[model samples]
Target: MQRHSLSVSELTEPDVVRRALDALCREVDGEAAVAKTALRKRSAFSEVLGAAVGKGYFAENPLARVKWQAPGVSEEVDPACVPNPTQVACLLTAVGRQRGRGPHLEAFFGCMYYAAMRPAEVIHLQISQCHLPKSGWGMFNLSGGVVTAGKEWTDDGAVHEVDSLKR
Candidate 1:
């Protein structure tokens, strides 16, 4: 609004929204914004514009006609960075060798590696949730996990909050 000297009413045009998106693509660091950041910003803009239309501030959402495309993003993991069985065994052995908290952490790390459980899930795991047999495969009935959001964000003002698994 400040850059174009336009109010919310004037922003109901497709061209104006496109130009605003173009400006958003350029970052303060003189580099193009990442695809994820641009996508999230575009979603936020679309949501606000949609609300404005619902409130009769505009006849329609200008962003609906905008054709701005964010840059491509890759979500692939590098296999070389992942540890193999032998390396993981060595790391676990080292952890178990430590005196104080090491023994406790060794089992935690084992759960993360063997069951593919996240740290928060392992921290919140209960014995009843695990179905281990004398000499066979074991099962884990995962119910919830711990989230370490700041105390201010939680209802009880605790640093960690128990929440169901994310989608």
Candidate 2:
């Protein structure tokens, strides 16, 4: 019960579809898309092609014949991209050299490097929670962080809401 001609065309070619999908697999910076994102796009495209076939626009799903696979996800970070302590110190120093906001952010970045605190946690840090002394080292009693959500998505209509620290 097909309404359209069965002739193959450039738009529906399997090779063309494969190439377009391959392009989608890589980001603009040439990095591969995350596994979950790529897989979701693939599934969505497949459904679209299935609908086209069901409506008699295509003879079959072209992607069904492609053998390409998405890149695997990994938790291991590349060591080369990691900055050493000296590099971090130099970066913090450079940040502190900026005119207006630099001096303020120097301590913020220091908390991230020295205490290994997340940006959110540092954002929510209070002066009262700091145990700074006239001595060697100081301590911070971190409680939670501030999470930004859309106003419509929040119960109180505030964009920034206090949330517990992530485990």
Candidate 3:
């Protein structure tokens, strides 16, 4: 295996850090994948750098010195990609008809459309966290979630066990 050594002092310059990140972006797969991976890498690197600076390893975080400019994102939603009311109705009807199947899927859609939830947030919901009454007009306490961690068949080693919603 090849070992790479990067000194903190070398990454202190804005230009140096920018160049390193640019190189990383080029090495990534596609444009979308590159952007996503680069952003995550940049965030993780910044966090580590911040901790190192606080521990007196460096006077300041080098990553903080650089001003990153993200590429322009399309603000307009694609018409073809956006589902119509009819399509949505069909999906909801199908989901409602899926008896004996996982109720999580149907409930997830309801939470998303009616309760305004993100798909990731819905997937993490537990039965214990919900409080839907018999009246079906009450709120649910979405606290935590369980995610698939490989093929373990258990709720062990899942990433990001959050205690609160992003809001």
The candidate that achieves the highest TM-score relative to the unseen native structure: 1
Which lDDT tens digits does candidate 3 get at residues 1-167? 22576676778778888877666555445444345666777777778889988999889888766877644334567889967778876787788788776365666787787777777678777667677788857676776544444545435554544444665
lDDT for each residue of candidate 2 in 29-105, tens digit (9 for 90 to 100): 99888887888888987887898889888888878777888777776879799889999999999999999999879
After the best TM-score superposition of candidate 3, give how far the Cα of residue 37 lies from its true spot, in angstroms.
3.2
User: What local distance difference test score does each model get?
Assistant: 0.86, 0.85, 0.69
The whole-model C-alpha lDDT of candidate 1 against the native structure comes to: 0.86
Candidate with better lDDT, 1 vs 3: 1
**Candidate 2 ranges with C-alpha deviation above 4 Å:** 1-74
Which residue window of length 10 is worst by lDDT in model 1? 66-75
Prediction 2 TM-score vs. true = 0.54
lDDT of 2 at 98: 99
Could you tell me which 10 consecutive residues in candidate 2 have the lowest summed lDDT? 1-10
Q: After superposition, how far is residue 39 of candidate 2 from its true place, in Å?
A: 17
Candidates by lDDT, descending order: 1, 2, 3
Query: How does each model score on TM-score?
Result: 0.69, 0.54, 0.51
Q: How close is candidate 1 to the true structure, as a TM-score?
A: 0.69
Total colliding residue pairs, candidate 3: 1
- Candidate 1's C-alpha runs over 4 A off are 1-40, 51-57, 63-74
Model 3 lDDT-worst window of ten = 145-154
